[model samples]
Target: MSSNRDDIILNVDKLSKRFGGFAAVTGVDLKVRRGSIHALIGPNGAGKTTCFNLLTKFLQPTSGTIVFDGRDITRLPAAEIAQLGLVRSFQISAVFPRLTVLENVRVAIQRRQRGDSFDFWRSERSLHAYDLEAWERLSEVGLSDYAHVPAGELPYGRKRALEIATTLALDPQMLLLDEPMAGMAHEDVGRISALIRSLSAGRTILMVEHNLSVVAELSDRITVLARGQVLAEGSYDEVSKDPRVIDAYIGVGHG
Candidate 1:
């Protein structure tokens, strides 16, 4: 909890979403402090994903308000929100498979430099201008050794790192990650956990993740949702001890 409200980077007040007559989310209030790693977790059908969609503008809310950096962005378009520095991930993972790791990151940097307008007439020399920054991003994710390898050939975990590098190229202030460690072995999990922690130094990260271990290890704050509403919010230890949160997971058959 931020003593100074001004330090809160993202706030949602009475946020809700409905599908037909079913309310996927109802009056869910959330606050993420600046430079904190916040985790949103819950059983299936708890509306965590719905909340994510609302934040990213993939789904419009039935009623509520969202404020990013003190600015009301409840109705702003997704692209406009991303342009304002709230870019999402996975959009980067879609990087061209045939492209080498360096080329893939360079493509992302290119997109950051030149919006969506693909000026085919530009010379190759102009594109190389972004290579230096691309290498820096790859280095940040520990991909410098495989710079010339095709992105498609990267190991499962490295592929995830490459995706992260591409996302970092956008230089977003706040990042929204949806299950960043969805499919990975144990070793990869540790590696990515470290990578995510390192990335949190100067930025706020709000993620909806199911891996409780990963969430417990990295999250500075945690919000537990159930039945389309927030059931608990606190530090990982505090939330883990909450009977309601424990029951929600147990009740859902979540191992």
Candidate 2:
């Protein structure tokens, strides 16, 4: 909570998005500090995913600006933005089911390390190095035991962990996770939460999560959204106690 504006990692100013007449997000502003876990939470249809899409450049904003590490990146492509160290994991699992767990991560590492090269034989040493790094990342995420197994053969929860490990191999300075806990059992949730906490030790994270307990446990700040706008922004307790947020939840039958 100390003054760390100088450590600000992401700045979103008046970001808005619309689908024709439907406003998905309007005038949402946020500042994510370096190494902080910021959670965005709201009821269903709260525009959380739309906002995430806009920030990650999957969808262009109808208005406003997004600045990452002092660069105005609102107009950048998703791949371009990712190269700038901002990476996002989708709400749905994005993994190569047929590839081995280690191979999936190895591919991601190689892609990030060498860009898009068609010649696999051009850099055998580099490829091997990335494979080793991927194994290490898999170990970090507690998926080492499954490294040689086919990704599709792993349990749902382990597949999710593998996805996170693959993302980590990209060396993102800031990570955007959309409901990383979705579709998981309690044990899986706990495992993924621990992985998230460990991964965020020295990087910035902005996550859209419905699990309030996970948000409370991991977030340093919370942003509540409703009807395409930010209803409240504060620490978990402060946002939870806000009357507007309460009303928003009640209106959505989630209170």
Candidate 3:
């Protein structure tokens, strides 16, 4: 929403990814303003997931660069990228199924402090140092009531919220969410949507979501990609009306 160039926290220049003979993304440029909720939407197979991987360094790009918080991170490894505060949550609901909700967040906090090694060797009291913050994170995502419940026992939406709690434990400055609403039931969508909005107060979020109504309700800006290239970039009202975007969705049926 801020037009100030200096507020751009993530900048992608001519970003492309290729798989053998297929180019999944091509020369796509993006600018995400700090504290804005930016959505990347497209019909199925438009390379949204590939773009997320490239940005997060899960996959090396064939060309181009990614500048985050004014640092060149195009070639950084995924671990290094995460340490720099660019954390991502996958399309799948990732969590320690057997662990209690509080324990899950605590583990993430441990991961943040102790490199990739978990604190399984530490005593329970030693690990309790993270519980305060873990509880705070659980409270942030409205999961405080389920702190003692096993993650696997929570409903699907609660599992997703637990995933977000783990992500918050990383204390990310910018979060990239891959189809956060992917497996949500109807009631869970609004709950997760509200949680996402609340989380965006002082952070930047770049998400790939298929739920167009959610995008229209949450995004400050939207980028529509088709066939691996940027088809349109603007506000929801602007892109929703674009003939090209309409055609892309209709042609592919937006799987």
Residues 1-255 of candidate 2 have per-residue lDDT tens digits of 576657788999999998888898999998888899999999998899899999998899999999999899999988888889999975224478898888788888877877776356756675666776887898899998898898999998888888888788778999999898988999999999999999998889999998889999999999898888888999999998999998888889542
Q: Which portions of model 2 miss their true places by more than 4 Å?
A: 1-4, 91-94, 118-126
In candidate 1, which residue pairs clash? none
Error of 1 at 46 (Å): 1.1
Clashing pairs in 3: none
Ranked candidates, highest lDDT first: 3, 1, 2
lDDT of each: 0.90, 0.86, 0.92
The deviation in Å at residue 136 for candidate 2 is 1.4
Q: Write the per-residue lDDT of candidate 3 for residues 1-255, one digit (tens) a residue.
A: 356767999999999998999999999999999989999999999999999999998799999999999999999989898889899975223488898999989988888889877748889999999999999999999999999999989999988889988998888999998899998999999999999999999999999999999999999999999999999999999999999999999999887
Q: Per-residue lDDT tens digits of candidate 1, residues 1-255? A: 447988899999999998999999999999999999999999988998899999989999999999999999999988889888887788545467899999999888877778887565789898889999999999898999999999889999999999888888898999898889888899999999999999998989999898999999999999999999999999999999999988989999443
Better of 2 and 3 by TM-score: 3
- The TM-score values for the models, in the order shown, are 0.97, 0.94, 0.97
Count of steric clashes across candidates, in order: 0, 0, 0
Q: What TM-score does structure 3 among the candidates reach?
A: 0.97
User: Cα lDDT for residue 223, model 3?
Assistant: 97
